[model samples]
Target: MPPMLPPLARGDIEEAADACAAAPLLNCLLREVGEPTGDPGVHRLHAGGRLLRVRGERRPARPEVYADGGWHRLTHPELVKLAAEELRRHTGLSNSELPTEIIDSRDAVAALLAARARATPPAGPYLRSEQSLITGHPHHPAPKARGGGPVTGWLPYAPEAYARFPLELLGVREDTVVEEGDTTALDTFGEAPPGYRLLPAHPWQLDLVGARPEIRDAFADGRLIRLGRTAGPLWPTAAIRTLYAPEDDLFVKFSLDVRITNDIRRLWRHDLLKLRRTDAATASAFGAVPGSAAWLSDRGYRTADFAFEELAVLVRDGLREHVVPGATPLLAAALVEESFDGSPLNGLTDPSAWWTAYLRQVVPPVLDAFARHGVVIEAHLQNALVAIDADGMPVQALFRDAEGVKLLPQVTRAAGWERLVYCLIVNHLMELAALLAERHPGMDPWPAVRRELTRYDTDHGLPEIADLLTSPTVPGKTNLLLRWTGADGADARYVPLPNPLARH
Candidate 1:
């Protein structure tokens, strides 16, 4: 039997959940629509003309809005209502869905908090790190919203709750099997019938799509056959759709129809079709880099033609091969959240040295990939893994998720560079810097970042490096505004934040 979680009071759960949910919402409101009010931890919301203030940095909480000439503490629902009203006025557009999502996200956090209180985190450092994000996507309003489905539908599969389960195996008929690249790792999971090819599916995904007529019809016609679940359990990662199977030393990404953060976490056919090119380009670029930094290649994918997006399973390279020997690999995002058991950032006496070492491992590979191969890796926290040695210092950086990568000429250099800046600087480094600075007060992290960038000789080529170092504003993605305006998640629109890297 699983160990019992500590009993949590109903009121405590609600308050904790509200805080978790409100932080990201408040972050979005402040970033996209508010300006600093010259008071510490206070900003003026432009549309509502209301003064909003919150206590704490990184994860802002204890929200209060100025109204009726006095400060009023806003509940989770009130905060959502305020955000919706401000966004509607700011964008001059109405979105009923976003407001609903905001509420759902808060409720979802409540449920997760309750569940986690009773559950035990995974034993392994990597698995524990992967499941550590309770307050996901620091800037998105609905980071934990699981398609607004009931708690029963998604709670069992949530990483934050430390859930683990076996994958359902399926046999696709030889004629219906569609695959590309090195998907051979999948066959080892379970045996298929004589004439069929093995296709592993996430049970949650199967539960979501199994009832469809097309899927039912395929099963009836012997185009698809159930092969039972894998004996070994696969641990869900921070990205809910992806699972890490320790036994096989493999990572499998599935097409989850649920909207996670921004996009429906599905393996789109268009992305799958171009998976080989992108993965190969990334692999080659990392290979050319002169260091231990590695790329966890998306080896390939397998799916049935009829249920393409619904049934897609992507095979990503496991960490054992790419990670340096004697070093442990932990998700970079987990480090930002300090979610894992032995985070390097925790209890650091000299953060300056540690921050410098981190920049060395992470920054060079990204710059080299851009300069040499024109491959812009989405080096956001979730996509990055920093492996550390016995002393908990970074030795290697490994990146994954080829689907998020953009090749230079495919998107113009200008566009690709912008995306790179958002992912690398704003998403990855900035978050890490904030966490480091918060943990160790008086450590100015940006000068080390500036020094690292200065070492890169972009003088002959990319001028963006110089511009970035001296620029007043850095790109910050507007998640709340984008969702409110009903824009496609991939169609990223950035607003400018004061750049800390700029040398004054």
Candidate 2:
């Protein structure tokens, strides 16, 4: 394999997005490990760590091992040193054994593994990352009956990053496997099922997926289009569906669902459509410069289509893996569908607090993306992705799931343009303001959030976020409301986040 690879840079596209979500660790890893399986557009590396994979023989590679909250603690100091050495060794392996270039996944592995390890609890597998709870085999946490054809299961939980790599490393042939009852285990990096499910990326969706073809192309790419589990009548195909035209990903929700109230549904729906609309208008469009679907709207490309299951899949895959930290709502979800790992913020003393501050600070630049393009967006937590660096500092804010972006028709009409202020500022930003007020008191949270957004319009005439990466750092990192907690004990409702523009 190659000894060195060039640095990974969001340098152009994401650089202009927002500095808040930028991960230099991603950049560092790319320079170190070159790349790993799948995801060629980017690079990867063999970051060393005590990774623990636990899947049955049938679904061995499924991240249900790690993301199902199945993680093993890497508490031993010796294990940490070994991880680094192993990564260096892996990067030096022969190219025929494992190519050193691709989407730059190896670089992310260690950082991500470490972050997940930090999230692990001290006592049991709860915080340590365990896979024991995900399998459906008789010995699995949830045993299946012999009469089952296929268990009727939908992961109403946090999804893990696709558990496909370990299998590829083991040289498993995915085409021949993927049966309902077949199982295998792998023990290369620690523990794993030598066999598993083979749901690889569809070739046509490459533009959006960004996973490497060299590794995942075997599952179904060139084959016939395979449908997932059969759909029942109750599944709302009309609105729940999503559309993807090449680099585009769009979704919508009809007026339904018993558990969701009109307020929640309305908020959810508005954020959904508004986000897509906003991204299509701005640089949030997927797979392009200065865009992430939310940015695409600014360029004048409308949605190509829609499907409920498709949207569900998007949400599922998205939550499973993070393109940028804090961007996916799956960050807030306690339930997991698929599994994934690699969070830069995992080592923090107070991870929840860091996440809270992350959510609060992210709204600004996301709303700013709209302002840069003379557009308005529904800048809410659901609409934004929060990114924290290795040190747990909030560094980047990228928006996706376009359905949440909206251009205030009223504001646009008044100025002979779409009212970005209404959608971005009033509709979306205001709601988050309420949340910050209720969920994270103190520190002029509303103004602090607004300051970042307003700066885009006032300073650079609303520049896209990429340019902000190299730009100056804003103030406010200390929260004045440290003494205040929204609710106490296990019912604590508020988050402890530092003020983004704080002098502290």
Candidate 3:
């Protein structure tokens, strides 16, 4: 098993949870609303003008707020309160939901920490990496909110808890089956009755939405039947809704009713409708790129007409075929997450070489896809898989998540470019760079990034590259503000963050 937070007493677990939860909240508060106070690791809340001090950079912890002429340490709840007050004043808006989510996120972390102490982490590097993100989405205000549900409801499927279970298969009557693209892979799970088509559902999602009147009616009317789960256990990846089946070497993504990070994780109709086009464009772009980089195609989807979104299952190409033969594909997000026992980043001896190889594998395909095919992929950490050779050097990059891909003609070039810059440079590179810099002090990681971008721009002649290199600020997603304002989940709002590429 990969190393876990040392088994802790209940009090210690809560204390550790406080620190675990505070980092991302502090990051969000500082980025979206707080201003640096010029004192090291100190920031002034822009609205309330309160001074807050924190230690560490990659994952800020041990928050202290200035009051009574001295620093007072804050519990995670206090930190949440301070953030809520600041955001409320900062935006002239009150949000009951966001504050609750912040608290729930902290509580959820506590549960995951405790559960992890008792659970066994997966042995394989890829599965370990996929399940290793305890502090998920380092910038989101409530990265692990879990829909504010009871622990029992989510703990069994949580990746951070190292949970693995069989998918609950259901048989959708053949007459009501609605599918597109190639869904043949799904038939391998189980055989349906003569009149039914096999449909696999996430157990948690089935529990959450199966009781709906429409769904219940279908169940009663013989349109849906409960088929047994897969014989083997499937490992839940960081994206809680997606599970990887080792036996079959497949990834099955199901509609999860819970809200994870920014949006409800249901396979919405709109995205499903466009999945084929977006995925095809992405695959085409990767084919054109002259490297080992690959696109893990979302092969197809299967669902019932009566419960399309709830019963939807997406078939994705697994790593065995796409990854380089001798290399192991690790989740990109896991490399930057708090170090685990088998983490490749933790064992790195040559930071520069590792980073250079990483940049070469990750950066080129993204730029080429945009310039040549007009496909803007969400190349953020969780969606990217970096395969490393025996020496632990990054050799190949595999990008996924067709739902997040944006076609150029569908969105204006300017809008698409902003989204691309936000995902690739800001969300993906910035986090990894910060983690690398933190691990290896005095190592400036930006120059290599700048060089890679410069080389790509030279070849592709993308007009935005020159401006991006010198731009004073790059777009940073405003998750804290977005959540507080109750904005549409798909609507992206960005704040200007100091561009490190400019400095390099």
Residues 372-467, candidate 3: write the lDDT tens digits: 899999999999999999889999999999999999899999999999999999999999998888778899999999999899888778889999
* lDDT (10s digit) by residue, model 1, range 89-188: 8989988999899889888888888788799998878888899888888999999999988899999999999999999999999998899999999999
The residue-by-residue lDDT of candidate 2 on 111-210, one tens digit each, is 2223333443222211112221111111111111111111111111111111111101122233433121111111111222334322322212222222
Where does candidate 2 stray beyond 4 Å? 1-259, 263-279, 284-364, 407-447, 450-454, 461-504
| Worst window of 10 by summed lDDT in candidate 2 | 136-145
What are the lDDT scores of the predictions, listed in order? Answer: 0.89, 0.28, 0.90
The C-alpha local distance difference test score for the whole of candidate 2 amounts to 0.28
Q: TM-score for each prediction?
A: 0.97, 0.30, 0.97
Model 3, C-alpha of 27: deviation from truth (Å): 0.4
Q: Relative to the unseen true structure, what is the Cα RMSD of model 3? A: 2.0
The prediction achieving the highest TM-score against the true structure is: 3
**TM-score of predicted model 3?**
0.97
CA RMSD of each candidate after superposition? 3.1, 22.6, 2.0
